[model samples]
Target: MKKSSIIVAFIILLISVGWILSGQIPKKIEEEETDSSLNNITDNKIELVKVRTEKSVSKKFNKLINIQGQTKANRMISISSETLGRIIMINEKKGEKIEKGDLLFKISQDELKIRIDENKARLSSARSQIDERKSKLNEFEIQFNSEKNLFDKGLSSKSKFANAKANLDSARSNLDTAKSNLALVKSELDLINNELEKTIINAPFDGIMTTGHMEIGEFVQPGSVLANFIELDPILAIGYVSEKELKSFSLGSNAFITTSLNDKIKGEISYISPIAEEGTRTFRIEITILNKNFLIKDGLTTTIEIQGRQVLAHKISPSILSLMDNGEIGIKIVNKESIVEFFPIDVISDTNQGMWISGIPDTSDIIVVGQEYATIGKKVDQKLIN
Candidate 1:
């Protein structure tokens, strides 16, 4: 009777186990079906690269050529003595502002004045001698005529007529000599007057004296430098342009200048070199700016910005720029079909905010974020940035 009870208990346990297995099998099948559905969904839906994009629109961008330069004076000259003399007066001090024709130095004029007076006296004497010689010539001419008439009429001898002719010839020669002497004296007087004028040295233009004046009573000779002068009313900003940039530069174009002292000024392109420099292959350019206050100084460091041709360009942050496999600089953009594309661009100009670039469509969707993950020609999921 115990054995029979055991068998019946085993059967009951097996049936219970089978019931548990049946319930687990359906649950496993349901789980497998859910997983298969998930797999199918994943396989059917294409996974794309996620990226952020910005719509860039092209506009009229005035390209600017920025060049390093320096400030220069409009004109600079070394004032020098044109004659030998002793300095008697100095009218302009170092660093003094001078006007055109203002006397800057005075040399001793006593000797020149004396020479001029002597020449004047000589001239007057020469003129008097000429007058006396003319009178004598007239007298001799009249006597010669009278003698000739007498001789012709047989009233005077041949020797008497010959003597009268000689006298007339001598008188005429004297008059010519007197006239030559008068001319010589007149020339001497003019020379003396010119030397007297040289005793005073005046400013050639409105400028500032950059050098100290010679002390009074100091001797100076011709070609001796007296002072250094510079004209600053219209200053020049001088710069150089590369060979590639020379074609776009032109005379009379507008330019902007910024000095090391942070002084900003507007100017016009006054000069562009026709030939390039021998070694540097660069052309020189000069911008003229009015400096009535004389604040701009020579040799000051400057940056010159000259406006160039207008072009359609897009302004974008430099961070978005990328490099291609061939080492070309470019930017990645999304096409209408949501495919990523790499486009090479030319940098037009740069500013504080962004860089202007060209060589792309007038309107484009540029990849702003996740550009590194973007593959060329691969479709991407783009999100427009606000």
Candidate 2:
């Protein structure tokens, strides 16, 4: 009985210690939960994002279109022969400059000359025949008049007068036939002369002879190319313009060009095609530039710049550009409420200073730094660049 009573007292003491420890543990855990709640609240508070921005200024933009082209001779042609003959003389050589009417080729004309001589002889003979017929007609008329007077005065027989009249009529008819024959001969002579002239070919215009297709003693036929001639005093620079840029150009528009040979040429837009090319949908354009020295040759690669009208634009650094989630290029700006905003821009051109752009506001605070960190329509803490 004494041992049992001692065990009960120990159990009671253990219960009392347990109750005290449970009460203190609950209070300590409550304090820790409160502190954790306070930390989470602090973390959830929104913090302002800092960014670097610059106020955009508007400037007049001089639009310029850059295109590549090639230089061409103002006039290029292949001179051909009009008659068939052996080439006997070449007055101008290849690469020689010549003026209009300068004799370029001479075909063998011995046979042609003989034909002309024959025609001339025939013409002279025809003329002599016509004169002889006219003289016979005059003599017959005189005889007819004398016969009629004699017959009226009873000095001649009727048969004789009738014979005289028949002779005069026959003589007049012969003269008419002779005159017709003479006209035919003259026409034939003209044709022969024209053929003779064709034997000597002359330059059609002022140009440089680019080639000599026939050598001495070579036989050439009609339509055979004798040489190539090109006029280069006013060089043509040919190029194409995009459909979107077509409206920006017109005939007589001033342009500047640079060639592969480092030649700077000033020119005017001489021609603009009314129709677009089928494949590229581009319009053709030609610029006329003076090449008096003939230094600019054909087929040289060239770059041209055509100046367009002036427009209002903003200049911004290339780094300031960004892409939206929708894949549009734009710039981020700070609005009047100091909120991040996006404005799409069209890049007009690139310069040493920056990119000249359009389609943005005339005045804007462009976010140069931390643009990616800010969301559109969200407020930001902007740091202005001095």
Candidate 3:
């Protein structure tokens, strides 16, 4: 009786366990079916990111290389004194415009004039002495010739012939001395005249006197700075170009310049350095522009724009620019299949309206709005923009 009760209790425990498992298995299956239905509905209702796009039409653009530059005078020189003298007159003051051959300064010509006059008088005396010496030499030569003829015929004494020859030699020596003295006097006169010319300093070229003008009573020696002279006509616009862009530049190319004062002007490329600068590795360039009115000043900052090769580019607002996973700057566009695509671009130039860029299709639907939310290679709902 005890063994029968133990077997019956064990069978009752197994039956309770099986019934509990059977009820739990149906409930689990119903929950899984409900989850499957929800998943299907969610997958079918998936929506694409909506983006605002504009059809960008590429146009022919003249690519430009903009360079920061400065205006420089074509020629800058420090006018200096060439002779020692007291400044007697200042023809031009500081900031005065002058022309070539215009008198700028005048030194005391009184002393120079006196010296020149003295030299002239000495020259006259030398000439008179030369003439007298020539006459004496001619007389001595005739006498010596007569004496030699007589001596040769045994009609003149040896002592007389020798004396005549000696006198002729002395006269010739005196004549040579007089000629040398005359040359010396003439040279002295020439030197004095040169000094007189230096007393009146004239402008070497048409320019403006910037500084270094001395008072009338001030003394100046040779090599003293007289004035700062600069030529403003045909001024130079100086700038540097990178080594990579140097090949694109050529002599006589047209360039547009804008000064710090907002002066717009045109120029031509005049010079290009063959060797690059040491530290910057850039070549110096000079553009020549006419400054007839002298409006442009030296050292004024300027912007130079040089035209490059023509290329097809699209103009887009800077806000639409995007970046790729690799950190490359690009723009996002929708292809024919409505898939978002990233295109790497080269910025050709920028203006007030937008930036011009290249390296894209001739016509593309660029996602201007909602580009940040759009993923590359994913379909997007594109909305056309005006």
Q: Using TM-score as the measure, which candidate wins? A: 1
Q: Per-residue alpha-carbon lDDT of model 3 for 285-327, expressed as tens digits?
A: 9999988878888999999998766779999998899977688
C-alpha lDDT of residue 146 in model 1: 98
Kindly report which residue pairs in candidate 1 clash with one another: none
Provide TM-scores for the models.
0.81, 0.75, 0.76
lDDT of 1: 0.90
Candidate 1 per-residue lDDT, tens place, 279-332, comes to 999999999999877788889999899988778999999999998878999999
lDDT of 2 at 164: 100
**Model 2: per-residue Cα lDDT over 170-287, one tens digit each:** 9999999998988988898888788789999988877788867779899998899988889887889999999887766678888898987856779999999999999999999999
**Candidate 3 accuracy as TM-score:** 0.76
Backbone clash count, each prediction separately: 0, 0, 0
Which regions of candidate 1 are displaced past 4 Å?
Answer: 1-53, 151-156, 334-341, 377-386
In model 1, the worst 10-residue window by lDDT is: 89-98
User: Considering TM-score, where higher is better, how would the candidates rank from best to worst?
Assistant: 1, 3, 2
Where does the lowest 10-residue lDDT sum fall in candidate 3?
89-98
Candidate that would win on lDDT:
1
Instruction: Give Cα-based local distance difference scores for all models.
Output: 0.90, 0.88, 0.89
